[model samples]
Target: MRFSRILELGCILAGLFSGAAARPQDELVTENSSACKNPPKRVEWRQLSTTQRKQYLDAVLCLTKKNATSGITGAVNRFDDHQAVHSSQTPSIHWVGHFILWHRYFVATYEKALRTECGYTGGQPYWDWSLDAQPANLSSTKAYSTAIFDPTTGFGGNGDYMQPSVEQNPLNITGNTGGGCVKTGPFIPSAFTVNYPTPDCLRRDFIPWIINSFADPKLVANVLAQKDYTSFARAIENVPSFDQPNIHGSGHFGIGGVLGTIGSAAESPGDPLFYLHHANLDRILWTWQQKDLQTRLNQVGGPITPFDYSGKNVTLDFQINMGRLAGNATLKNLLNTTGGTLCYTY
Candidate 1:
């Protein structure tokens, strides 16, 4: 197992994550932020120094070297713990009322793990796709040329040509350029391992067209112009079949590949880029919420079920959890980034 290769780090993860006694459900997690007095500010990926970028990658590597608390077979390391939980919760979290709330909490939990477990001191960085998806840049190569895909400082570039073993949903979506294993970057098959849903290389078929189509500045502005949370969520997440793809799908399909674990929606976190991608999404959500915090912060209304717009609306008190990673939290606490268990700003 990956964790066994790093004994000392394994001890750190075990003592910190597994060896602790169970606490009451009401206990605060990560840090009980007394205030956002000096909350760490998140920056765009380019804003970070090359050294800072390397440090962030190192923390992610450390996660892979640590033992997973979840004994599930596919969860070979601590990193896979997230993959397992996300895959399990996909149906409940996405397309629902708490989609934004639950993901906000999930990303915060990951930031905490990076800091407390892996000794990464920097705040999380986001990948702003808008800059790359501009109309002039939409000529196909602009988004693909981003440094975020750099083999050295970034996650890596496109995978080679190969066929997908299993066909997932959203059949209408087109443009999958590469399907083979990633040949370069920090997470090439030789340097990194992804064991969920059977071991495989981190693959990415970069369909820059998808990014250009959905994440253009005009579309993003449209999403932000939404009058309420429900409209905003639908604008970003779009419908179940992804017929009307949104920014969220832009990032996912733009990267364009089954992950190292090799699954689309559910198995996305298997790739390290998932966090950076989602961090940017969360930043957009936060940006929209700040327009009128009094109303937007409290405003949330969508179906309780995935793709079921006519179903019951999930309330603020709806519960979300990350198994042992973050026990449980409510949509209420997750609404305000700085006020709840979260204490970060973008």
Candidate 2:
């Protein structure tokens, strides 16, 4: 048998035996890797000191204040450049083979911009939203009430309350609590603006049901239990329904308003929290990969065409394009978070 076939089979077997174990530091990714001499450690949003949080927010704002460096003709700021890349290639990237790997690269590039361009000193931070969606708080998830929405210290609170008026792709947003523009928080009209499909307020409609029912810890644990790389990817990307709630999609709907509305599901990068949100998903993918790193670090499978399971299977050599932000990279280079092109760990 060819090495690729042997490798693919190994990944399937490892995942079958690897249950949804809690994320661990079983083997340090960059500890002995020569390619990454000093990898940055990604932490949870709440782990950052007040100063670190302030720095991250400031770096994001700095991108907003600068002019675009890419050829995205519609973009107005450095930050908009990233979304322009996403907005154009939105459909091709999601519900496809490259979904998780592509987003991991995209978020890492954004993080690099935050550090290299905006002078952010620390690595990227992820928001473990499940902590706020535990069973105890299942009835009324601690989503909107947490410090993550602190007007002074965190991303601002819910937009002015507006009844739900949306139903998109996989999930329904009828239970949204805020639909108007965000009036508080760092990205409010006074402080931030998004320029894609036209300039608009950064809106958020914290849906407790999304948290209580869809994005709760149980969904995450379930996704982690999948028996293979392909199965895990399919599970994570499942559209939410009464029987199944997508952990990945739930994060977006949980912050419903404009992030959910713009581009169906593509232009989420318009919201500043998009990076933090994606970082957590990457963390989940990374945790899943860590459980069987030997097999998983090289294991990637799914269709090349978005939502077309019958299409050609994407291989490790498939090229993922990111426009001008980070240019093109192969699926193999992005497989491992540490020694490959990426250099960070959660």
Candidate 3:
């Protein structure tokens, strides 16, 4: 068999076996040829001290080299291509498919890279928003609550009560003003709502709700109100999949708008969190695969034509070379595999 064919077969087999056992270190491979291990539980966000945060951030920085950037671009191109082919006809189906494929590769590849490059040995940690769902649990410094919701500061505007904006306003006047300025909010006692014409449109204001929903029931409801990761995936699975105005269509607008706005406004690489946010979005797809393994695995779909942006038909294929997106070794190899070297546990 040809090498590519053999690789494809291996990937299929790996995907079938992914759920069978606890992931072992040897199953993962990196450029360094060393085994990767799971991260320590204490490495979670709340547990990290100031020094640890600095260390972790520095390590993450080192791992995100120029080459890593290129690899990410490649992954994006693949995604763009897939979307163009499949979404045009059945948008919802296409997006859910896109989510699953993209996240499977992302988590697998990034985990391997973290293990081999930064000596990071744990599973990826998620920011749970359940802790601050209630008005009382929010802290001045850590948790967002009525006490810290600042209109002038961190993403959202100040005070427990502030003026809300129209749902269509992408500037996030209630959260992220212009580009850099963010307003902080103190936790509100009410169940979070993302009503149209309320600055909460598109769920931008729900970031705090998402951050606090991990362990809190009320917070989970708040996050759910804005379509938590699971609901987002389910929305894709539901009929009229792509047309679901709230998630996929809005998601495209959100991502495309940010790219356009940030590209025009700054010379620096937009937000570092851009990739991380996408990564989390990708993780939702991974979780979906775990839930409906057979149905998800049997699928084979992509876009029909490349997207037309500013009159250009963007190319989508593995052959095209993207600058920072092309160079990352882990991402480069991941495009062709179901899970590649690493198996996802959670």
Off by over 4 Å in 2: 1-33, 134-141, 164-172, 240-243, 257-264
- Per-residue lDDT tens digits for candidate 1, residues 1-346, read 1111223332333233323333464455433457445667889989999999999999999999999986555788888888766665665677778887878878888888898899988888888888888555544767877888888888888887655444432253455678667777778888887777467777777766667877788888998999998889888877534446578777777786332223365457878888888888899999999999998767788888767888888777766777677757767677778874777898
Question: Per the 3 Å backbone cut-off, how many clashing residue pairs does candidate 1 have?
Answer: 0
| Top lDDT hit | 1
Q: What's the lDDT of the predicted structure labeled candidate 1?
A: 0.73
What TM-score would you give candidate 2 relative to the actual structure?
A: 0.85
How many residue pairs in model 3 have overlapping backbones?
A: 53
TM per candidate comes to: 0.87, 0.85, 0.40
- Model 2, residue 266: distance off in Å is 3.9
Name the runs in model 3 displaced over 4 angstroms: 1-44, 47-52, 64-96, 107-111, 129-178, 181-270, 300-339
Least accurate 10 contiguous residues by lDDT in model 1: 1-10
Model 1 stretches with alpha carbons more than 4 Å out: 1-37, 136-139, 163-173, 241-243, 257-263
Clashing pairs in 2: 156-185
lDDT (0-100) at residue 333 of candidate 2?
75
lDDT of 3 by residue, 95-155 (tens): 2323434344444444445556676555444333223344344222244432212222212
Provide the lowest-lDDT 10-residue window in model 3: 260-269
Clashes of each: 0, 1, 53
181-284 per-residue lDDT for model 2 (tens digits): 77876888888887864777877777676666666788789888887777788788784243556777656767763233321343478877788878998999
Best by the TM-score measure? 1
